[model samples]
Target: MRGCLLDAGYTPDGVRALLGRSAHDALTRGEPEPAARASRDGDELGTLVRLFLLEDTEPEPAVTAALGDLDPLLAGRILRRTPEGIRAALDVRPYGEGPGDDGEPGADWWVVSDLDSPASRQDREHVTGVGGASLSLAAATVRRPVGSLLDLGTGCGVQALHGSRHAVNVVATDVLPRALALARLSCGLSGVDVDLREGPWFAPVEGERFDQIVSNPPFVPGPERVDYVYRDSGLAGDAALASLLGGLADRLNPGGIAQLLGSWLHVRGEDWPDRVRSWLPDGVDAWVLQREVVDPAMHVGTWQRDAGLVPSSPAARGQAAAWLDWMAAERVEGVGFGFLMLRRTDSTPTVVVEDLPGELGEGLAREMTGWLDRIDWLRAHERDADLLGATLLIAPETVLESASSVDPDGGWSELSTTVRRWGGPGWEHPVDGPAAALLAGCRGHLPLSELVALLSYAHDVPADALVAAALPAVREFVRHGLLLPVDGWPHPVAHRVAAADPAGPVG
Candidate 1:
């Protein structure tokens, strides 16, 4: 079956080239007319695309010619014979990436899941294929080689397929047996080996730990009711995500990392970061990035549309009212969705939660790893004296930008100065003139203590006062990759730094 699909040019790139960019983009938005027109030709690729992707029927002879011996697919209920012709009962889409020019390998495989459409809504157990959340988790996941990995709530096994390329062993779990069956089929089709388990949450993996775990769990915020198995956990509010976060420490080996996509409630008069931080367990470090937040109405509308409910329809309106009422009663002002990266650490847990809205480009895995490494480096030099004695260097991609305006006297005046990173997370930090000058001297040549002393002598300010104010900002810069320690710029080798100069502590 895989060979036949490949021979018929059914890969991701091939399909995009065949459908043309405009039609392919339309097909992704769930509009099939353009794809229907593009795949009108009676070729093998067209037959498969029409039969599977466009949800259109094909003549029996064409189906047979495109896929030899339809008996297996028919028996498996992947296809059905009708009076008009044969129609696809399932969705088998090509999914993968080719090796990159930088010598990084890639994956080439297919994903199998139940057919999806508003016109043909399935039951709660319906499994979905590769989606936005799935792709996001895969992209953000740390791809370093590991001995074992756990794919929690592995719907259709998309993460499991990606994990197989890096991990020596992969275990995937789902609460629904139906989901597990489809996940098994996905692995089989991809020619990858994954241990498929059936149970809810951590039940299937009890008493076991993994080097890494990745999940795009059912994180939709709603009442304690399950309308769809793929998006509902029957847990009130965002408790499903909370439960997952609380149990992560025990399931991860030392230094193990877990990356997940989740949604959390934003209550009135409450900080969202604090609400999420309360869910973390001890002996674990976490970094939460809130990508987006939506009001109650938008949240309800989005999920309702996902469930194939027309916004103007009576049923959708009724459900939306109930969902909104529940949110109002619970005091949920909005819902925030983002990525969570947690690590099992032996030392004190460090949690950084913030709103980072924008495009997170490629190499996210590398950037995330770098962030954690920086955290370790910062934790080592916690004291002011220790950090000041350490040499620092600015990141290569860091840039400084300033804005100026013409004053009434026809003279230019600087308005604001900001330091930003060009790649990875693209974080921006606003800085004052003195702080900017301090960063400019971080060329991996001298200790931060000396830099502060020199700046104090030049400005004629107390060195102690300068050191006191600059240490906090320096830590922030290092934490966010704007500044790097000379000894451990790229990776940390030791936690402790040398003592401050004997002349006297700058502060």
Candidate 2:
């Protein structure tokens, strides 16, 4: 492979810079190249290269000619670019010099996307990169300091770059050499130290555990992927994702967690949450924040275009129709997409499997890690201690005041509608009345028990009776957001739905 890379104009110095001594040793050892006998499932480079050969639909001549330029010593990768410059690299790439700003090692190479307009060969969908899924997942990552980090399916290396800022060491892996190069470039640009490895999910780092792991894996099942091919696993609905999730618990260290972004296929009559839940490993705390679901029609349209299938061409027009047919035939209700944050631990983790694409996911991801940091048994209850202590102060503008007098005749007076707050006054009931009498006594100063006792005593009633009577007012206060519990109380139904997705609207 190195010889092939050299033929492609890569240099030995380039190879040494990224692979280091171990990689060189593997390439030089008399032992069968781990990349050869190893399949896509292997942690060795053999598996990564095998996956490349298996997955590539590229013509043999192009691949063979590309490989002819062998330079085991130099960094080399193959990238296919559109005449317009838009490139989506396919091979495991070699590194070049680091970005001038810092001495960080250079990137592995490949072209998954070229600057060519979206109109170039096939999928007409807009191309997205670190700016979208990668960045979103990065922003949602747990900030706790960790000793080492793993970026599975590192792609352009965005997740690895994010991890570099926190972890002492970073391992970024991918099946594509081109992707490795791009990741290297990204690391170079960020001036971060990252060890680039070419292998599938836990492979290259076999037997190694990290305090943190983050991935924006190629979870977009074969169906709804971007035409970039680089982004999709090219596997059916959830196979790839299952492999990732099913395999994660073993890779994570105890107390360590992995944060990921992914796309899932929801089958009819099959509970999507349950399907995802089935993938969680025992004792691994998990949170699956489903952000959106696109119906068959939308999914088909979205993915066909992504594959560069032009709706205008007769062939593309048929392709689009076929996609729609396939989805409907499968009764594909929608494609579920979300972020999964998992931690390996002894405690039963609260797994929030939801269908949310709106503000809820953003808010949940932002706060959940902190919530996880503080809670012991997330699965045991939805209630958190912090929530139990939380206070909800009513806004001044929304607070209502009261002025009332009981009818002297002991008859109900006309119920008038008027909103008022406390006038500039002291501890008076504001207007002597049962409601006011009860309200004025509630000074955050009194313990609930004591306050109830006071109310009972003032009313000359049994404490139990007083509590029963005062409950309505308390309920009203809750309605007005005047008070709130700080405890993270468990919800009877563990699953909660998230907001609507902005793009793939679900019924």
Candidate 3:
């Protein structure tokens, strides 16, 4: 049945194409899905759409034909047959990235969760279907093949589905029994085998470790109270997130990586970086990207609306006030949401916390992998002599921008130059004329020392002073991926091509 649906153009993109533009927009905006017209049309795909995708009742014959060998008991549990028609008790939709026009591979998984939004009856234990956060984590997931993987708080097992494609075996867990059931159904529907467990966080995998761990945990710094099992953690403030991070060390194998999405409370007069950094276990390489920060009032309203609270109503206003009061009492300044990637290692660990763009770009995982390698290489060659002797290449995505102000004479008065990386963990750095010339000349063919010597002679500056002035900017360039090591060994050895790409886009 799943394959048949795919054959008949049942996909995320297909759904949008079939529903027209306005209906597609309405569905994404959380308005009631525009399904009345499609449901009444009664085409084969439309019949299935009404019965399953739209969470609406369908004729008995349509239900029978859509699911050829569906178990009667399971069907009964999924739908309630009546004199007029059989109404669906569950929601099933085509889910995948969808194939690109230029022949790119897309997701083809069919996800099953409780009926959401307009179809929801406000079940406190409701398992959530696919949403923005879920897709964000999925796109951000690193897809290196692994022997074992763990999906904590695996709501509908979407992460597990993605994991199964790269991992030999996947273990997914959720505290809510209903969530585990739904995850099982979703994995089964997608024909991906997953070990579904009922436990919170790392409880089920207490002593076990995995090669990779991925989670889209319930990290909402809450109203301090909420009914949704899939969103609320029942813990005060960000304790749930704290616990999840603190325990990551024991759950990962050596060199194992964990990618997670979470929300942390940012209190007044406290450094957010210090608070988040304290959660890390010793000897772990960590990168924390603070994606967005929402203040108390806005955060409350957003979650309230998600919980079906209407903003203009007096009740909603009261709830919002109470939420603000709670945040105030807790000293919460804002709620920071973002992604964390942790690697367990015995070597000296590095921690980086910075604000990055909200959207995950293409090749982010590969970019991250490259970054870790770059960090390791930089850490090994920190001294001036070690760095100066090595050859450097401008990053492919790097572009040099310059602005000049005219003097009274109209010749070039002053020139300010900046080097910006065009893609792959984008970054920009200001550079002086000498530094810019040096970067432009160090194109993997010549050593940095030779370039610095030539520049010092041309500019009539001492070579030592020139290298000293350029050191800080050069370090920043390498650290931020603007400059890459290409060739010429620091030690007495043959010239070697470094690990980074040397001939990327020059600009």
Of the two candidates 1 and 3, the one with more favorable lDDT, higher being better, is 1
- The reply for model 1, stretches above 4 Å from the true place, is 40-42, 98-102, 403-415, 489-507
| Candidate 1 lDDT score relative to the true structure | 0.84
How good is model 1 by TM-score? 0.91
Candidate 1 lDDT over 450-491, as tens digits, reads: 999999998888998888788889999998878888775533
lDDT of each: 0.84, 0.54, 0.75
Number of clashing pairs per prediction, in order: 0, 71, 4
Where does the lowest 10-residue lDDT sum fall in candidate 1?
498-507
All candidates in order of lDDT, best leading: 1, 3, 2
Task: Residues 1-507, candidate 2: write the lDDT tens digits.
Answer: 444444443333533333345544564442324324332232223222332322323333344454533232123333443444212243233322222112234333321222222453343322334335654675577755689899887777756765665578889888777567666655653457799999766889999888888887766554544445456676666778887888888887888988888877788899888988988878787777777787766766675565556668797677677667767777777887888888888865556575442253333332455446434422332333322223223223323354346788996564442223222111111222444455454444444456556666776779776655545444434322232223333321232222111110000
Task: Tell me the tens digit of each residue's lDDT in model 3 across 283-318.
Answer: 799989888998888898888677666877897798
What candidate 2 gets wrong by more than 4 Å, as runs, is: 1-113, 119-128, 223-228, 360-365, 377-507
- Candidates 2 and 3 compared: the better one by lDDT is 3
